[model samples]
Target chain A: MQRPVPRRSGGGLARGIPAVLSVVSAFVIWEIYVRVSGISPLMLPAPSRVLDQMVQNRVLLWDNTVPTLKATFAGFALSLTVAFGLSIILDFMPRVRRALFPIFVVSQTLPLVAIAPLVVLWFGFDLTPKVLLVALVTFFPMLVALVDGYASTDPEIEDLMRSMGATRDQIFRAARFPSAMPYFFAGLRISITYAVVAAIFAEYVGARAGLGIVILNAKNSFRPDIVLAAVVISSLLTLILFSATALLQRTVLRWRDVEGHR
Target chain B: MTALSLKDVSVTFGDIPVLDRINLHVEQGEFVSILGPSGAGKSTIFRLLTGALPLQTGTISCASPENSFAFMPQRDALMPWRRIIDNLTLGLEVQGIPRKDARAHVAPLLRDFGLADFTTHYPAQLSGGMRQRAALLRTIVQGRSIQLLDEPFGALDALTRTQMQTWFEDRWRAARWTSLLVTHDVREAVALSDRIYVLSRRPARVIAEITVPIPRPRLGRPPSAQAHDIEAHLLEILLHQTGEKP
Candidate 1:
């Protein structure tokens, strides 16, 4: 019989085991504290109760999660497209890079909470406002990473290219773009996590569906376990998105390891 | 025919002239080494020849029929993202040579340079000697007749540098291309070149053109005292140029 390949456990799971244990321990403590302290179920539910609620309202939870996932994915896609396009434009033009960099920085400073309502008012409670909010939150980091990557091109390598009669476009394609992959992936990882949070925040302000809406409905109905379930689901979603970005990074940057230097 | 000619060539960075009204010529297939101390403007000559720097005054031109030139800078300017083969084909690719065609030419060259296994490896993965060899291969693969090398093996260790010197000599002997190398190591210049040009410091000018009577394949120990004497003479001129000697 052929021997099966020994499967390597993902570092993420190994690293996460202790964290999961700590969180479960903390939740157990919270459950005990709530029970002993005479806190009403409406005020705070135990971890067991939250798990029970999640099981009971699995379909309802899925329905709410769908909207949030839709908004997050849509907004993230838009943000990625916009950030990538803007980075390329800025990279091509030094004057544009210098002129727009401050504007991009200023965009990040505009508090999303303040802008969320305004976006809702302007674009209404539809998907447009939610996407705008997520895009606004996620764009800066990607843009900055791309710019840094472009700037990080080794000058000596660039000189070599020039001496070889490489045109500017040739140099960028051969060196600058490849060199920037790590930085770009790093930015994407950061922004993807933020995408989920931004979408949730936007949904919290005004939304017909989404985990945010589910949490708000649970809170209004005095169902603390339902609220906790929604929170857990959202956290899981964020983790999934983060893991996916990491996977993408590994695939794209596999050549970097082969190159010897990071 | 002269491969390269610099007639009254002067290069000034702002008010300071790094190479002042320098005149030199390298005949076709001749190996000439520019020997001087650090900051002797030996590198500046290579830079000017390679069009990295513009001549401030006078004409500097290559007279070779092939006219094209390749520069091997002091640092191994290999792109970390590119594989060894891709790095070697970079010049050809840039010059509008199709990837398939470029690879066809570069594949054999990599094998010849003992870098066939490393074709898929990145520059970061290679050792100092390997990187230098890869860089040289890249320069040669460009199909340039004139090679302007500025301390191509300067960053390598003594052992690796010696190894590279032998590799370079063997390759150059086979290729029979005109090469002008700028180096601080006297023995390296003496071992590799037919003639050596000694330059003065700062506002550098040719102090002497010392003929290296030493035969090829200068292996084993270092050269004799007579070789050191010529090196000392060149060093003395360099030190005097820098005003280190009265």
Candidate 2:
């Protein structure tokens, strides 16, 4: 952990301080606005009240958080599997890609409110509906990223490989797959965020547990503080998942980041 | 002995004739170049050889067909994710050599290519000339005698191009591999090739074959008058084909 850091990533302290300050100052301003305006906690909770609600219901929050995280991870993994399978098939068969890409795009345009409850109705409201909804929302980005990545390789490199007696599979392994990695990571970064939000939305459609249920319950009961607390937890989860994706990309694609400048 | 020979090769792209009954041959331990204007189907001939494009009509025979040619493309085409060593050894790996063994085979040559210290560095870490050197090294380390280069250093700046050309000319003198270079650069063809084949523009046909009688280490001395005369003649033939200046 104490290893000498390259200037690019090592300047994180300089880069992060302003963002941290901006967020902190936003919360401070919110706290002051609530105090000065004397807002009713039911209508709009103070930051302090939300913090207290979070602490008081910590056990309940933790229990609900487990289910949300479970749904997110399960759904995200399914998305990755299906997307990878489709992208590879599309890579090999352009006809298949041409036939299916339009359908994939049209799937993204489907209204989630119209679709999520139907998925719940069909899959019966357990972990299955949640995972299906997440996969439906998240798989497209990863799939497109992978397809584009595979196609992005220079044709000259393919010829070079062939002249050296490389088979199609060999060309893919040596050139296409490695070339596609950066795009794949970019897709993962996008899809992971969608997975987290989609998980919460899955619960809102009809799940028995999760932060979405907590928020919905609190909203009905006029406990804005509880609603805001749940919102904060979900946001934090999204941030963590996004950061983890970034870290994974930096580690696996180390060659791109060598010498810091590139 | 003849290393590779092409007989009556002709290509037409959907009835637009690209190459027309071209006949050429390369001898073992010789540096040969095909000089043509940009779209004279010089690349079409290469594409046919590499099997990127189907052979419309041709008989290409190699003395040792089992040995694959080390082909260097104009783009350098270095895999960015791979370190210079891994990139240089990629051809060996393609030929079914294990990665560790390939690395061992290329380790001794990296230094001579000016990439010894940079072997473990990624391609993005190297300069344009260095990356081209690494690409050339990758081509040679396959242990193949025939090298097909399509303007391998054409992307570099003038100074770097000259340096690489000089370095490559010296290497060709030492090793004497059977090579076929495809280029539109007249001076480059005259500088490095033992013999140059000039091709006419579209519907390309072999117009002339000129042998360089200049002495070795061609770049070692101020290019002799004979080398310049050959270059001017080749340029005149190429210009006549392009209808640019004759």
Candidate 3:
């Protein structure tokens, strides 16, 4: 006997109520805290002032955001290619996995804050450093997730594939790779959040234009509202990227999600 | 000539022996079962036969090539992402059959397998018996002369297992492929197998080779006294292997 799969009743908008409520409550609390604490605009701009500044300087903010977005996407794309390549190679060659996995772990331990400056020193004030920083920060998690995914393949399924006269590549394409999709998306969700932040951090160390530069400029000019506006914009970009990853994961892995009800 | 034969097959893991000089055979179109309690190296034999594990010291000869047998493991092992039709046609696809041809080949068989309507459904959407039915169909559509079934009904509940045992019997009788089943259940062995090879625990060896001479369609009527005698004798041998009184 089997348990019937529970049908999903509400669509996205219906299920989005709790999330909307939580966000509204959080914003309300922040607005109240700023007004009651009587913080000066220079020290901690009220939510209303930050919102006003964001609207007034939307053009300037958007102009700087273009560079940060480009760097993040560039680095994220590079990281995806590298991680996919390495994970496949390492999965096929256990010796390589053994030799390189430790080195990758050590690479992650190198703090991005420390490494970003050095990367900028070498790559200069162009987009390369920011892109490299984003790639460096996001690579290991996706690689680890993929490697573990490949390793965790059901041996029985692999054996079944082999018994059917499937070659190594056939087994990989049919069983190993498909099984790893969920883990890949999960890794992407985690790494996507880091991509934008890493880009901003690299820009903070050195950049001609970006959200990092915008924040740095606002800070130098002692406009806390503008700084907070940049901060809000950067965070919004992260949220947007994260939500996009989640939505993509849901679409691709719609089959797996049904296992929850089962 | 026998459809498949294993002579002096021995396997060891590190210092521990798993199967020792095991020999068995299946005649063409025969329903054979290797019966033993759990940890009897039943799965080890399967792995060796399927070429997943190295055959340490024995010779395994089959009428067809190594890949000529379709295997159904203990778990359904259905790809959750694929629909029932896709899962059924996986073996054909892996053997270089194009998806279109594979689908066309498997589509007609789905109705006989009682999975015609469920072709578009995912594995998660099927019942335990239905999933196993689909798995069995998947193996058969591989166009293999021999089928290796490793406890195909082991995961089902007792009631479903009984129902499936009969259902599988009917299917086997109709298809009549050279089939080898590995299971620990004695009644199942008596009910389904034309011949049963009772095995000892670890480092498995053939303890008894009992032929079930009962007539076909053994499920509809009460099992004959001859079937009971065979079941009892097989159980006694199995219990003896485990150092127990039957």
Candidate 4:
């Protein structure tokens, strides 16, 4: 999509070519190394073999991808909404922020490996557990970014707004919120990548359909190529989510970029 | 006609007293300045006038309330994210005026302030002088009769500050709003203000109030003899307040 294009002219192709070339070169070396070294396909699949398996099982891969994508988007959306709402409440009420902030930190300290299975046991094998896992993993960064953004707002601007008869809500809307936007996007980028990983991990523990299930099935059948194929798909999904966040950041925070040039 | 008055005002932040029994007033259609050394609580007086700092012990009576006055602090304080015109109309927007109407209202005044072509430009694009001019235009467009400026030109380069001083003086002569300026610069206070009040160090109290003996249209090379005399007198008072030999 045109939306994916980098904002600067000519620089996009100049910057993108090197990165694309490096990945392609890595795959080429890997393909050649595996073939010449006489390594067993069971241990490490050759790049070409993985590509072949991917084409043969395209329908299966696509079917698995659909469920993972759905879970990730649903969980990411839930996390974003909840984080935004909580950050706003914490910004206005410092006492509440103080009381709840440590609890949020403690929540993050609980390993997902220990908690994901419990979440699955409680929610059954439905999408609920996967979604909750993603939410739990992604919410903290977004909340911290927003709270920090709101707190770091320039006091002079706030004072100007207040002197102009702006109410507390007006100051928050005009000054605090806009200043917090860049930070929010920073958090969103982090959470987005985590959301995808969390969704797959949740599925690995318990899910009827998804790339995690495909990987598990391939591993049991000793189809290393098929597992690698699913790994490639997951990697692509993470890249897409990451790039989309960068594009959104560029669009919304254009002023910051303009200021830098000047 | 006196526009505003603060009688026997005293302010303390925790146990530290900022302004002690301060008394000052500005007349209608006059430019008044408060001159003091740095950290003499000059800005605290402004904060009090704007109602940003609550009145500790004082009687501050303005012809208009705090909200009805335009206040410009030392910093330009323009919203970097907003275009020049949008930042100018922000106050109007806060007052329940529609954005379109507020933009329209400021559109004509932009030419007067030399910012007609830069309406869409962000604050970062402007020079120091241009930013201060935009800030001043933003304040003036509020249509408030009382203006409280706290060292508005203190951030600019010396050349820019001088240019801004002349520019502001020309405008003030044409449209005399009841203006109160707080600055540590003696020349700035002398060049622009009709009356100047010199304040002492911490727990600031007015030590001298000198009315400019020079007549209006006080601009150009080699100021009047009276202007020179007043500047010397104020400088001496400031030196005395700071316990420095001049």
Candidate 5:
């Protein structure tokens, strides 16, 4: 007998309450720890001090954030375009897939920190190197996801299509691409976070502006509050990117329910 | 004219033969069943007919071109992402049939197949029986002259399978398309087929060809003694082929 599937309600507060409380609790603990320990504000500032630093330097924070955001978005767009094109090429040609798959695996092994300085020097600390670094880090996951998705398509379905007189291009458009979507979304979610981190790391090596530069300068000047504020902003950026990807996934794959449960 | 002809057809994977020197002729609009136990290479016959696997030896000929043949697999092969209407029109779409025209063609079929209400629902949202119906709808909309079904209803329960068999008979009689079904169920083959071909185990060879004398829509009504006698005879033949004593 088929069990009844439960209808989901889009109750925002029901889902948000727990997450909001967790953040609140963490802040409360941080406030208590700083006050009770009597730690110097320079070494470990209170959450309030971080908030004050954010408000006072809001203009500076915004100015630095724009460059990092620009690099991350540019890199992400370039990576997606190249990765998607490469996946299509590889999917059609098995020999190319076999030849390039090993190269992709080896490329991931190159150390980011060691390569970042050379990239900065080569590109002269401009937006180009930071974008390239981010693209390098983000491309592999999307490529791998697409390949696995293409491979995992059901052979039975493909055979049925062939029997129906569908050409190879038609089979791919109707069946193979749609089946690979969930996997592509999963890879995108992972890569979005990595894109932001890669951009920041590149900025840390050498950048005239960006949050990473602020953090490094604050650490040298012994201003822990400014460093914490920068960290918080970066985390917020990561959260925003992740949530957007998730929303896109839900909208695109609205037809498919998550398996085995509501 | 003969719809399908297999002359000395043989299939092998490496050294082991799956089908050996099989010969048969299916008349146009006739419903035939290739009945056998598992590993009898009944499915290999369907694959060969559909050109999914290459013919190793001898001549395997279809009166129609590749596009004129439609295949239904043992399991529901519906795309989970597509709705029933879109799924049914997949064959048409792949043939470069315009989406507007395909939808128009499939609209009447949705109502005919009792799937009008569920046309917008995805395959995952459907029951097993409903999925099978949707699959048949897709196959029928392909408008092929020959349908190759490999145990299409084997996965359904006893009750659903019976209903599907009756539904299939009604559709087959109405559509008048030639069909070659591969099945292990002796009673099912005897009930639905005009003629049943029994295959021997492993390197499968045609052992017997028995004509089913029962009329269309056989089941629900009490079985006549003649139907019972024919069923017993077919069963005995199958048992002997599998080396079982009656």
Candidate 6:
């Protein structure tokens, strides 16, 4: 007897309703808090003022945002490539994986904030530091995802492929690599959110131009309106990148179960 | 022609002895089954033959060309991300056949496998029976002369298992590729196998091997009375292997 898998109806959009509502309500409450508190704009500018600053300083915001975006994209690309290459190599060389995996874990313990300054000190106030820091921070999660994904491969499938006269590389291509796709995408979602934040922090340490610089200047000048405006813009950038990754996962792994699509 | 033979073969896993000795043969185009209770080390034999496990002591001789044997594990083992057609063509594609050529090669057989309309569907979208059928097609599509199936329908419910046995019987009769099946189902063994090897429990050895004299299509399609007798005989031995009263 085939037991029908119980599926939640109305699709992913239905499930996402509460999240949308919570965000909207949070924004509305923020707008009200600013209006009623009558706080100093320096201490707490009204959400409306923040919105107005976003528009008023759009040109300035855009120029700074471009550099941060460039750093994020560049860093994310470098991180993903490095992670993929390393995961594949480690998967092939078990001796190397066993030796290096503990070192990688130890490396994660080195504080990103402390390392950011050192990276800047070494590379100077330019794009290089930002890119290296972002890649340094983001590559680990994807690498972990890939290593765990390779491990998650069903041993039966490996045996099946081996029985077919497939080479080690062929077994990986047909079974192990495809088996890791879901995990890899999950790692991508997590890493993409970190991309913008890491870029901003790196720039905060040192940069010629970026959102981090703009936010620091605004904070120094007591322009909370501009600072909050930059915060909103940076958040929006992270949100957009995250959503794109999710969309790409849905497209690439559309063959997965309906429940996974959500 | 003798396509495969295992002579004085025995397997042990570290301290555990799984197969004491197994001497079996599968002639060209013959359908044979190795039957026993669960954990009878039936699969160990296949694993040894496929080089998945080291042969502790004994010899396995097979003159079948490289890539001439397809081994199907118990689970469907389909790549969840691949479409049904891609999953079916996995063996061929991995053997250096390009995807387009593999797809083309299996296209005509999809209709026979009842998966023509499911080319684009994923494994999760298909029913359990359909997925198992797809897996079987994947095995057959390897174009292998010898196919090793390890309890292919063991996970199915009773009714589906019965139906699949009948369906598999029809397909096997049509092509009659040299196949060695490992199953614990007595009726299944009686219905499908030309000759059967009954194995004892862990540290298993071939206790008995019987040739079915019952006629063809001895399944849901009104199997002969003799088929029932053979099933009963096999079931009793299998139950006895597990030290149970039959």
Q: Which candidate is the best by DockQ?
A: 3
Candidate 6 TM-score to native = 0.94
lDDT preference between candidates 4 and 5, better one:
4
lDDT by residue (B68-98, candidate 2, tens digit) is 4778899888888887888888888988988
What is the per-residue lDDT of model 1 for residues B4-76, given as tens digits with 9 covering 90 to 100? 8889988888887788778888889999988887887887787666667766788877765343689888998
Q: Which ten residues in a row have the lowest lDDT in candidate 1 chain A?
A: A1-10
B20-112: candidate 6 lDDT, tens digit per residue: 878999999999999988888999888887778877788888866465579988998887878888899898887778989999999988887
The DockQ-based CAPRI class assigned to model 2 is: medium
- Name the better of 3 and 6 by lDDT: 3
For each candidate, what is the lDDT? 0.83, 0.87, 0.89, 0.88, 0.86, 0.87
In the range B1-246, model 4's lDDT, one tens digit per residue, is 788999999989889988999999988998999999999999999887777998989899887764658889789999988888999998898889999999989988787788998888778778889899999988888888798898999999898888888888888887787899999998888888888899999889898888886776676667888788888888888787788542
RMSD of 6: 2.5
Model 6: per-residue lDDT, tens digit, A131-196?
988898789999999989988999988998888878999888878898899899999999999999
Candidate 3 falls in which docking quality class?
medium
Off by over 4 Å in 6: A1-17, A257-261, B244-246
For each candidate in turn, the interface RMSD (Å) is: 8.4, 6.3, 1.8, 8.0, 2.3, 2.9
Q: What local lDDT does model 4 show for residue A95?
A: 99
TM per prediction: 0.92, 0.96, 0.96, 0.96, 0.96, 0.94
Task: Tell me the DockQ of each model, to 2 decimals.
Answer: 0.43, 0.52, 0.67, 0.48, 0.60, 0.52
- Candidate 4 chain B — worst ten consecutive residues by lDDT sum? B213-222
Q: Which residue pairs overlap in candidate 5's backbone?
A: none
lDDT of 3 by residue, A1-262 (tens): 4456667777979899999999889888988988998877798787889999999999999999999999999999999999999999998899989999899999999988788889999999998898889999999999988998887789889999888888999988888898898889889989999999899999999999999999888999999899989999899999999999888887888787667631
Overlapping backbone residue pairs in candidate 1 total: 1
Computed on C-alpha atoms, the DockQ of candidate 6 is: 0.52
